[model samples]
Target: MGVALRDIIADCKETLDLDALKGVAAIDAHNALYQFLSIIRQPDGTPLMNAEGQVTSHLTGILFRTANFVEKGIKPVYIFDGTPPTFKQETLDQRREVRTRAGNAWKEALAVGDIAEAYKQASASARVDAYVIETAQELLGLLGIPWVQAPSEGEAQAAHMAGKGSVQFAVSQDYDSLLFGSPVLVRNLTVSGRRRVRGRTITVSPERIVLANLLDYLGVSREELIEIALLTGTDYHPGVRGVGAKTALKLVRNGEFESTVAEKLPDFDPASIREFFLAPPVTDDYNLSWSAPDTDGVVAMLSGRFDFSPERVEGALEKLSVKAKQQTLDQWF
Candidate 1:
């Protein structure tokens, strides 16, 4: 999970139509995969699986969602996380525990025929395992979508690419991309559409956040914004108890971040976290070339191997073909 800075940074977000987002975007692959695993499921929250009991929800998501991106003139380059920072081990362990509990809760809810509760619990139980990652990369190749293996955090690598102008922006639902100094961050790109929330159907649209505008609106430097995130907790460190985003912002603005950390979290060093965000581990050794989708390969994998409907797969490929023909490879970059 990313830092909870949405509450304070809401004003800096700009709602955008799909037509306006025509450019190269570095997508956080794991984040998008998690969204797929969570959202693309049966009524009872059972994920789509093939004959061998392998999960196909992510494949469906990659095929259709990436097609939609291409149809909308967006070139997406996926970035996968390699190794996480050592400081993030606790967070990883905590996430595993949460998923385990949620998985048990999902089974219990399904046993009791509580579809809604099962769905909720199943979403929380979504996991991105090695099999999921490997298959996702395979399908992406068939779709002619490039993917990079980041040396560390995927979001940080995406931010690094965006900062270097290798891509127009970083696409992720998490606000941590901003903390990582991505000049621009696009949210809700993967799951944007009509969504149900609390029994009410709502439309979710893509929103863009520019780092400079956010800093200007908050009247604090990027460093201060990161400090705000630290006070409200991050994946690396549990923040001070009872400090929310607004309170953290105030504390940072009033120049009390160091003093407050000293008083509340005397043993923790904020500098380490700060340094990680400021200069996270990243690599420049990656290719970002878009090419024609391997139609037969895609069909063979999705339909022949997996149990996806051949007709639906063909339709999705048609979308990719129509858009790919309209824009050349040079136009994408």
Candidate 2:
């Protein structure tokens, strides 16, 4: 999970039409793949799988969603996460426990004919395994979409690309990108459409968060913001008990951050966490390049290998080709 700063940062977000977004974006590949595996499932909680029982939901998502991005004039560069920091082991372990519980719950729900609960728990149990990553990378390569392997967290690398002006923004569903120093962060890019929540259907649109505007609005420095997250919670550390986003914000603004941390979290020091977010490991060795998709290769992999419908594969390729032609014509003028 990301840092729990949404409550304090809600006012900083702005909704935008898909047409308004254009330029290169650094996408968190793991985050997006998880979304795909979670949301692109059948009503019975089963993922889209091939004859050999291989999941294809992620492949379908990357192919169609990347085409949709190209249609909207957005060039995406996916960033895959590397080895996580040692401090995050606790969080990873907790996630594993949660997934195990959810998986058992999903099976129980299905056995009891509770489709809704099964679907919900299956969504929570979604995991991005090595097979998913390898297949996703292969599909991206066939589609001619560039990907970067980060030295640490994918969000940090995406933030670095955005901060360095290599990309217009970072795309993730987590607020941690802001903590990672991404100048601009776009959320809901992968799942931006009609979605069912609770018992109602609602429209989900892409939203943008600008770091400078957020800092100016909050009247706090970026370091202070990280302090707020530390008091609340983050992937690296469990925050102070009973501290929330608003409470943490108040503590930081009142200049009582140190006093509160010392009183509540006597055994924990936040300095290392602060330094990690501020100066996280990142690499500049990646090349961002977009090229025409390998049409025969894409068809062969998706249709022949994975058993996707040839017609749908061609339809997605057609969208990519049309967008490419439009861009070419616009440039020639």
Candidate 3:
């Protein structure tokens, strides 16, 4: 449940390209992998698998997409989530239930030969298993792409990096990063293509949201923004029974948030959740560096273990190498 600020926020612009990023990006790794698993499925709703029957969509997504980023002079630092806050357990359990239902729905739709419905449900049912995560880590390591394991949510860590000026932007499809104080957030970095709406599919571009611009335009402080999010709902808590984005904003603006929350969520502690968003767990025990791809390591996993074409693996790595060299040369100058 990302912050539902889309209805109220107007500082977003969808005119960004890879070349515009020309700086470091802190990516929400788990989010990106989940997107890959959801979108890279075949027409019949089956994921691409290796000879041993393991999913390879995540690997393929990371390889080609990250290479494109690198080739365009954008340095990406993938951030993986660690432990989750106890408050988010409910949200995770609900997601599991949705996935289970989606899985059944996907099978039923497929059985009935409803191809479109099957594809939609299959996308909803996609899960990033341990194998996918581990293989992705191995591949990122082999490609010499720097990654950080967050103490909690990857979005928090990515936001921290951006806020601290360690990266150019905090990259994710969620608007929650704004609550985490990321100076800038980029959405659709991975899925920058056509998106389906109610009935028609429309081509979409990458968009950027600036924290300062949003706050200034909304006439609310960052702290107040958190209050609005708490009132509307978040992954950690199920906001007030009847509150919504518009009403939440009104309450925040009128300084009635505390009174409203007290009446609606008498037994719940909204302050703590707000504080958690204001400052989530993050770490600084990682370095941001782009080195030559570990050719042997990449070969071992993609070719030896996963049976990916050796030529394809080498070709992708070669692109990374060329960009790494170009980055180094630019730095020297």
Candidate 4:
């Protein structure tokens, strides 16, 4: 919800209270680590270190954070990426090209004495591959949490499982899950809202928005919803030049949805649109199992090889314990 990471993290502690993170099976963004590192290389003053020599701060940051969540008693099941959707490859390609161009622009900014642009580009580059699947796998291994190597976006696989009655819910910052038909999605997961309410600091529990409710608001079926997102432009696909979210929603609501979109698409083919919704971009060999998080294995992999922070790992498990007990008590009462 918030922009800056620092502000977001601060809000999480102030509002939702990290202490309350419990029993929730967190689906970690496996692709974010490599993403951040690819964007930000060490500055000129800092000579480049070999892969093995560099402290690998990116991995450490993720490991430390995930471990902390574990300590809070939330059972994190770190899902790793497999292959991406065929339809998404084009989008991925476009994003990578943009990053490459930005790198060039950053150099120019530095030459032209625009430190602000240079810094901004540096920050953007740092965001690339910050959550690489392999990194998450290594980190989760150390913390005793379970890890799932999905065949696509970790969240998509997680959402699919949740919607299909496999998991309780899917947790992620991305709202795209709604299009993927995930019934439940909780936002501000690692962030919180700040409400200064007088003498006592009252932290609100994290809020959630289910897709079903969103559907009710939009007055569209899940299939129609996906169609709606496609028209508006999603991460996976580029939408029409002029069409936007609200406009797309209006068209959907108006009538003869496909024909309406075709009218807008100077060259829109009903067949193409139909195929997109009939079988959206997804993996083939995706599998979902209700295997519990492997606490010991996760801990061993992270701690032994990745040198992950043990304290954070303990913190997530602690949260889980308290939540489990509370659930038990509530059931009895």
Candidate 5:
């Protein structure tokens, strides 16, 4: 569970374009790859796979998607997750259980010819396995995309990068980055597609979330915001029973947080969680640079090793190289 601040927090959104970004975006790698795995599935619920039965949906997303951004002058710095904090183990277990259930549901739906339900469950069951991640990293490397291995959560690391002025924004779909104190968060950076929401398809655009504006609108300190998130449940901990965003906001506003937490969450130590968010483990040992894709390396990895269509790969790379050269010429002139 990410922070349920969506309902209560006011967002400072702007329609994003490639020209508006001032610096590189620190992308949460797993978040993006998982999204790719979740969406690039066939109608029959099977993922895009190569001849060797390796999933290539993540690769397809990375290649074409990053190429699109690069052509339009938006630079991305992909950040990968490291060892998770122990507190998140339970949440990870819960997610695994959910994926298992979704897998079974997908099979059942496929058996019954419920194609829509099968697709939905298949998307829900999508996982970023070791091979998928390793391949993604390798592809990013060959493409000359900068990627960092974070000390912990990728979002946290991205947030840290933004805070340190290393990047302009942290890119993710979750609100936890705000708690990590990222000044900016960009959501829906990957696509402009229709989503099935409550049985209807809805179009979505990229939205920005500015931390300072949100805090000022709510008239709460960053710590108070964290308190509200704790009350509203997060990936690291289950919130108190019967508490939600509204009630949590009220508690924070009324300065009754300690009392209410003591009464309803006797075993919970909010401070520790607060500390975890405030100073999540991250690193500054990485370089931030964008370069032309290593064409030979990219072709060897995707076509020779993964069996992706060499023509398609070359076409996308050709466009990327052309645009990159144009941008370089424009910069110099």
Candidate 6:
């Protein structure tokens, strides 16, 4: 559907005319690192390092985005993925394989002095260190946002908070929140004012979608819908060969999967799947509460350690201060 979480934010910004965000809590997908920093070893044994002798994008994005959202006045709650579902491992392995092939292609392009292709391929080759979920947690502490390391996806943590009436909505660019059965998943929670991407000025108008309503229109149970999604594909499984939303639903509705396929379900592995739905359980890991924005924490993490500009960090603080004042004024009115 190309229906990204960021798309939701863009649409919300366009349609709802949302004010500087006042109440809703925002959640980050991972550590918000910008680039890959680990190591890439070749077949014979060679290492890849930038001119600076290290990787930084993945770490940098964490600092940048935390400041980014705080400035926009959204209270961010950073969540990191912990132990994952067993089925997810196959997806991760495939991603590395693709990156390896792409990296080789890029390396070949670079060797030939093809500047564009070199830059592209150089980008393709470094695939080792993108996993920076830990940095996200650390940065969250620094930015003063409460963070939860969930046993699984960050969206699941965000969804649980919203479902239990703790915060307002789960915010991210991923559509999987709906699959996780979030009460509300606010998409595009990160778009800022539009700017030129290439020669053209790209306008970004972020928006939110009521997943409950979307589910209603789609006309399948949420469990089956997500399962169908899994069968079709996800960020976790891009283009899973045998399935898609419609087909998955058809299979779920049919209720005749072989025992081998049925064995993969999380619910099925549990002694009883009904217990999961019956209680609407909230995982115990997440915590959501605060005195105000953790301004000092934000500054310390970004400006102090990662070299984020002070002005950028302060800009976020200013927005949170404004939101706090607005609430105070509204109380009088």
- The numbered model that scores best in lDDT is 1
Over 4 Å off, model 3: 195-201, 329-333
Return the candidate ranking by lDDT, descending.
Answer: 1, 2, 5, 3, 6, 4
TM-score of 6: 0.68
- Compose the digit string of candidate 5's lDDT tens values, residues 1-333: 477787776444665764566458888888899989998989878999878898899999999988877766678889999999999899999999999999999999999999989999999999989988899999998887889999998889999999999888998888899999999998877544467675688877777888998888889999999999998899989887788888899999999889988998898888878899989998989988777789999999889978889999998898678766776644411
lDDT of each: 0.92, 0.91, 0.85, 0.53, 0.86, 0.53
Off by over 4 Å in 1: 190-192
Q: How many residue pairs of model 5 clash at the backbone?
A: 0
Q: After superposition, how far is residue 146 of candidate 4 from its true place, in Å?
A: 1.9
Per-residue accuracy of model 2 over 214-269 as CA lDDT, tens digit each: 99999999999999999999999989888999999999999999999889999898
Q: Which ten residues in a row have the lowest lDDT in candidate 6?
A: 36-45
Model 4, span 155-224: residue lDDT tens: 6666766666655556665556555566776555543343334324555555465666666766877777
| TM-score per candidate | 0.97, 0.97, 0.94, 0.67, 0.94, 0.68
Which candidate wins on TM-score? 1
lDDT of 3 by residue, 1-333 (tens): 576777777544556765677788999888899989998888768888988798999999999888888887778889988999999999999999999999999999999998888888998998877887888998998888888999999999998999888899988888888899999999887435677664488887788888998888888999999999999888999898778877899999999998987888888877678889998989978888778788888889888988889999888888888877766554512
> How big is the positional error of residue 113 in model 1, measured in Å on the Cα after superposition?
1.7
Decoy 3 TM-score against native: 0.94
**Candidate 4: segments with Cα more than 4 A from true spot:** 1-22, 26-57, 110-115, 126-131, 191-207, 269-333
Q: Is candidate 1 or candidate 4 better by lDDT?
A: 1
Per-residue lDDT of model 6, residues 1-333, tens digit only? 221323222332324433545455646454233132222223222333234434445545455555555555566666666665554577677767877886787667757766555554554444434334555556556455677666665666667767767667776656666666667766545454454443256765545666666656556666655555555555544433545455555666686333424654434332222223223334775556433557787677656666667797677666655555565544311
Report the Cα lDDT for residue 68, model 2: 90
